[model samples]
Target: MDVKVQKNLLCLSREAAEFGPFDAILELEGEPDALWFYREHVSRGVPCIWRGAVAHWPAVSKWSNDYLRETVGSKEVSVAITPNGYADAVREDLNRFVMPHDQLMPVSQLLDVIERKEDFPGICYLQRQNSNFMEDFAELWKDTDLDIAWASKAFGAQPDAVNLWIGDERAVTSMHKDHYENLYCVVRGEKHFILLPPTDRPLIPHMKYASARYQLDLASREFSVVDEKDHGVIPWIPLDPQKPDLNRWPQYRHAHPLRCTLKAGDMLFLPSMWYHHVSQSQGAIAVNYWYDMAFDMRYAYFQCMDAITDTVAEGNCCAVGDHDIEDEQELSTGKT
Candidate 1:
């Protein structure tokens, strides 16, 4: 058999034997100690949900629209506005990967649009991940913890970024992995996640496209795609987990996706380098802590696998930091 064909068969076999065994994400009733968390989930690269992890958090009960308005309504914050709910996703019509139009608005105005009390021309999301909870919404910090105690102890460091996310139901996070161990906490509504482990990287397809940004014309309430002429190109996963086009990307058929819905007060320990696509209920609010992934043997091994997969997939090199739109201040993209 040919080398590429052999690699493909190997991936299929691995999917059957190794990947298919773990059909569900482990859900824990109470918070585990740092040692238990590391041994069971963190060290092994397993994802788990700690039910009612932050149920006692004041934010869970106090973070209503009226409360938010009373607390931080007048504050000016960054919002990602897009014609469609998708920010930082492949725009098939334009044949480009586009970022959302970043707009500055008061917290009150953003809530108005989310609540449908006021008619907004475009979908607005406060999904900026640059520690927005600490910097932008500092006034509301008293409601939630600065960092998860056990998680910080297990990681042996403070969180690099604590992000706040509040958005419309249509706002979708595209499939991508991060170089950080993420602890995502839902405060208001439910968030649905479609997760694929790093071991299944061989089945995922990546494509390179010219980068663009959404430019909104407030006067006419229209969005235009503006090409990033200077930035050149970016490699992104164009596959939508909700509707995987198997014909175009057949390898995706071999991928095993674990679906989980995180309701209010739930915290999901999303391991590093796991590809995920996320969607949320309307007016959902969330906060996530990103701890930098250790560049250890596991990371080096992953790089080797990534290189081999790319080589076997017609020389498609895995783009490092391409999907690092979480830090939009440094990276440019519309979605997280």
Candidate 2:
């Protein structure tokens, strides 16, 4: 879990081994030369262990659950009250308003109604109209801003909006990807985020799964089925990227998967287009926020036109994106 170099360590490569993956290692353990390289580079990607992250704030500590629940459940209001005042809850909501409705909004009418707070006399049933909760929230990340990291303020102008998220064991966002960049801060309790890269759009074959191809039938409030095959009986095949489990999806080894671990004060940077999955560790948690605009996101642009959410496991296949993608390729390749 340790990334920094300890003293008496000979040759930086020996120290960097702890991080795994020999693709491109950066051992900055007390190395001024290595640290200097990152500062000068553009589009930097570095995973630093828990260094100096902050604790939860009164507002966040006081009511993060209340905020996410209120926002996700409410059919209206992109901005919410954060005990402090009116503020943008997420940049994606704003982007939803600005982006063409057909391109992003889950519901078209939702956007038509989202005029600036100045004009629309608070919609009767909306959160702002009926609730006493504060409308503004401060960004979660105020201290750990790295120069190599993307300029969140420039892209998102996310000075006050929340970029970080925290929740209890109950916090669950049914498989879905956000339109904005994310820096996860794990403080307390446990949260699990399941993620798939953008290229692997097939994984979101079900409503239970995240996908771009599946269109929402607002009138029925139901998902339109894309494939005729009863996924319950047969499993889809997928290419594995990480340590392939042949007993599971043998093909998984072929697929390049990216995983991460974030402990207390541990922050994770998700560059645009990278599919992510998160699981809250069991413990106390805290995090800051930052957001960026204009990403060539994989979802909105590339639809999940085919079924791909199927997963493999203890002998069973579920239709709603939970099928075992039996990697036939694994057997042929001698991986299984």
Candidate 3:
């Protein structure tokens, strides 16, 4: 690492430690007005929780397993399958970053796997983030509003995508940042989030890993890692927030991670470009809205900082300017 770049990172780490939001995420007992949300949380790029924000939504109580089975059971849905319940995460065993094997199956079958009613070969999660709620699960639309009126008004537009999430306890979302302002609501079980503000970017490490995918052998109930050489290499964070290996990535010791749990009916406002890792209780169900982020001065500054971090970590200053930064939201659904 270049001495100047290392010094810059050290300075950033100190700044975050001295002046960052070291406290817990601000919690609001009820929903706030659009303008207040825009000014306090959105514009400031901070996270806050609205306790029981969506408690009134009928889906909170009605979207149970029986309800889902009766509604979308027959419909085929896209499911991300992995042996370890990690989709689009760096797998140290394979020494590569692997993406889940997408499988199409009936909603009932997927529920069976989640409910442990059947002995499934792999961990299954309904985490397709391409507006799957609006596009695929139309039957459940009436249960929840299409858009959050306050949030839409605050953002000055409707969400670009409304994602539906349902997964097992083991299904963990790796730590990463996204380009969209996210509003996440939990309707079923609980979701635990470990969040690090964008200011902590310098302390977080990034590495390029070989691209790969998981493939399952049904008859033998075995899973194999397949390399995707065509896709070349991909950059990913190898650190596990639950148990970060400080020895390998020592800079991470300076990071301050704020933890929060969103239970049924609670909503979380996750600002754009904030690094977050998520875990859930068994059969946790949630929905989230992704609003396009403004590519203004803040984004430009973040990009510049990202470039510097990459240069310091890799000893290749040109690496950042040469490649387009991959959209973290596109590859993963845990933007919240």
Q: Put down candidate 3 lDDT per residue, 152-260, tens digits, no spaces.
A: 9999999999999999898999998989999999999999999998877877778889999999988999999999999899988888889987766666776779999
* Top-scoring candidate (lDDT): 3
Error of 2 at 209 (Å): 8.5
Instruction: State which candidate has the highest TM-score.
Output: 3
CA-lDDT, candidates in order = 0.84, 0.31, 0.86
lDDT tens string, model 1, 1-336? 234333443444354436434588888898789999988888888899988999899999999999999999999999999988998899877789999999999999999999999888899999898888888888888899999999999999999999999987988899999999999999999999999888777677777889999999999988899999787898889889999887777656656799999999999999999999999999999999999998999999888877766665664432222231124232222222
Clashes of each: 2, 48, 0
Q: Which stretches of candidate 1 lie over 4 Å from their true place?
A: 1-9, 12-21, 315-336
lDDT score of residue 107 within candidate 2: 16
Model 3 TM-score, 2 decimals: 0.91
Residue 123 lDDT in model 1? Answer: 93
lDDT of 2 at 119: 29
List the candidates' TM-scores in order.
0.90, 0.38, 0.91
Name the better of 2 and 3 by lDDT: 3
